[model samples]
Target: MIGRWHGLVIDCPDPQALAGFYEKLLGMIRVQDEPGWVVIGDAPDRPGVALARVEAWQPPKWPDESSNMHFDVRVDDRETAGEKVLELGARRLEGGGETFDVYADPAGHPFCLVAW
Candidate 1:
């Protein structure tokens, strides 16, 4: 059986941009960086975000199409993180108030900020 989740691979138009957003929002660091690929992690060992630079990346049709997957980023300050992600160019999608805030990255990849 699977013990734990290692990481999640995200398809985006810009890996660097998406990775950068996650890095700032989650306070994660780039554990690995290469052409066409980037990985971010909370610590030196635990992986969090794995990003791929796709040339033909097409964002999922929002509020209509079914998303194959999505991510939830738990944070201490939902408001702060939401503002921070917005400043980083992420678009607000759903959820708000004191509980959580959902946002879509620059490439339209959705993620959530949950109060920690």
Candidate 2:
């Protein structure tokens, strides 16, 4: 490969705040923080989640073919994890199966909570 995969960048209104959500959800640390850019992870070399500020950003129409990207995080219990995710500012969304549930972050970016 030419270059390594550094991180996944998410566009939102508040970069730091959105990054904070991923930090709390993934139990990661904020390695870099600035006005419109933030990266969450203890190790820069490893995969991280980055948030970039966007003006008047509109969230994607989830479950639609137009929706390009999303995250799938693992959890042991679907029921318990679903409850916790709601507390973490994730809202329930449509289109998921038995082993996985779809949720939207505070910025309305879609992600999946998978049972493992």
Span of 10 residues, lowest total lDDT, candidate 1: 94-103
Residue range 1-116, candidate 1, lDDT tens digits: 86888888998888887888878877789989988999999775885789998899988766576567877788877878778888999898854556677778889877778885
Q: Can you tell me which runs of candidate 2 are displaced by over 4 Å? A: none
Please give, for residues 1-116, the per-residue lDDT of candidate 2 as tens digits: 79988888899999988887888788899988899999998787778888999999999877674448888989888888889889988999998898899999999998899995
Give the residue spans of candidate 1 off by over 4 A: 2-4, 94-98
lDDT against the true structure, per candidate, is: 0.81, 0.87
- For candidate 1, the lDDT comes to 0.81
Q: What's the TM for model 1? A: 0.81
